[model samples]
Target: MRIGILLHALFYALVLWKGSQASPYWMGLLLGSGAGFYWYGYNLLSLRETDTKLRGEFGSWTGMLSSLATMAAPLLSGFLIASVREIGYPLVFSLSLAFFAWAFLISQRLVTNEESELPAPIFCRRHPNWNRVLLGNFFQGIREGVFVFFASIMVVMATGSEWALGKFTAVNALFSTVSFFAVGKLLRWYWYNESMLIGSFVSTGAIALFLFGQNYRTIMLYGIITAIFTPFFLVPFAARVFHVIDEAHERYEREYVVEREIVLNGGRVLSIIAFISTYRFLPREWIATYLLLVGSMQILAVLILRNVGFRLKKSF
Candidate 1:
């Protein structure tokens, strides 16, 4: 988890630095996507060795703790961008660099586990489950990139200020923080997929109001709705993926989970790149239009899940 945060902080710092040079957003996307693909491909070939280490060193809880970092990113970024608006982008990059350094040092201090002296057995790579995980990851990436790429544009168009977008992001972060706790409780009552499907529908409904709303209210409502449901949708899918990996590791004695996760993250990066590449070409007014279109797509995801026999059924 610490290593991942260090890497993320570095990545964002580079983006801020590069953006100062007037580099196109597409370039940042390309860099991120290229790095992800290279990492994913390497992990795929080294699944056995990677998993063996991860199982002995980190295990499933690494994923749960890592999730908190996701919530922290936008929150920290929002505050930094706001406070450092005077010093400008370079300062922001430097600040992010400091964060990376601190996180890296913390990761180095952690002790290594010694239980993993032997190689694990490899599982069936051909399982249909891998395809489902991959596709789900792709769509999840698409959803994330689309929301991030246009959200600021939409806020600025509606509110006419970058500062407004910062406030909106901060609000969403607060909501995300709250949702993290809320979801831990919600899981006791709902199945993981069911939580995701319901949250998607809830978020879709909130987004639909943007077609009529023009004030900060639109963004605030969107943030609140997304905050309420994102963890519900996101955390469970993550936990279940790790659950499957743990089960596989137990049965096969091979640690394929981390490698599989890396592949999934790579797929996610490609999906984001594709979305950003296409969306960047659209006219500015189309930003709001695409938000509406994405909301409809979320609705469609719900329907697709239902028809494909993925709807949650109560089971012990």
Candidate 2:
């Protein structure tokens, strides 16, 4: 996992570096590789499933920590872009590369997974129930990928400065971190789907409001609200993935893990391509268009989750 993350950080930095060099194709290839390897690295190469490994709302802790760390990136990038101008992005990416390398070093010292008896595969077909969750996750990924790819650009378009983009993202990260922790605790005490539904509903309303926004302030506000509600779907959905896959069939745990990554990466690739293709054409309203797409997909996700057959456990 650490190596994968380190590689992703490096590749992602390379892609961003290409942005300045006018190498769009190279940037796309690097971006795709980074995303693909990130999945393999996190779930396959680094993961060790033990009794404690699969227990509790593990996604929440990671999500919050990730957001907390990530909040600094945009802020620092904004500062660097403002101060050093053209060299800022490279510096930012280089810093990211260093951070992940440190993480890799630390992870090397962690205990390895304990040996356990492997269960025989009983089911080869994907569960109808599991499919619904993956469907929702995929659509959500599309919305999220596009937003991440274009959000800073949107801020830059509106404000003409990287600092504004940085501030907006920093606040969004703050909200996400807090929301993840709060919603994580809430999910442990209440039904996971309930939090997921509430988050989806609120995020839908905020996205609707965002469509009418024209300035950086309103857009920043939308980002904050969206961040706050994001973990509602994210944390719960993650928990449900463990619930369905681990509880349903221990033997096929690894299969579902792969399937989840496929759905996520598929959506990411589709959305990024869509945005990159249309970025030039939809100059004035591109933000609105993608925001609408995100809102629309999120609504679709809500509908898809409704079709899920299993009742989520109420507590951790």
Model 2 Cα shift for residue 267 (angstroms)? 2.4
CA lDDT scores, all candidates in order = 0.56, 0.70
TM-score of each: 0.66, 0.81
Best by lDDT: 2
- Whole-model alpha-carbon lDDT for candidate 2: 0.70
Residue 106 C-alpha lDDT in model 1 = 69
Clashing pairs in 2: none
Q: What are the runs in model 2 whose C-alpha is more than 4 Å off?
A: 9-19, 44-56, 111-124, 273-290, 306-316
**lDDT (tens digit, per residue) of candidate 1 on 1-316:** 4434545665666677566464566555655554554444333333334432232123223333444565565556556666777765566577767876776686566554455466554434554554455455545554664675556666877877656776676667666766666666446423655777887878767776677765778777887787778666665555444444544335432345544555545544664665665568977556556666555554443433332222223552
Error of 1 at 249 (Å): 4.6
lDDT of 2 by residue, 31-63 (tens): 566656666546543233433234335677788
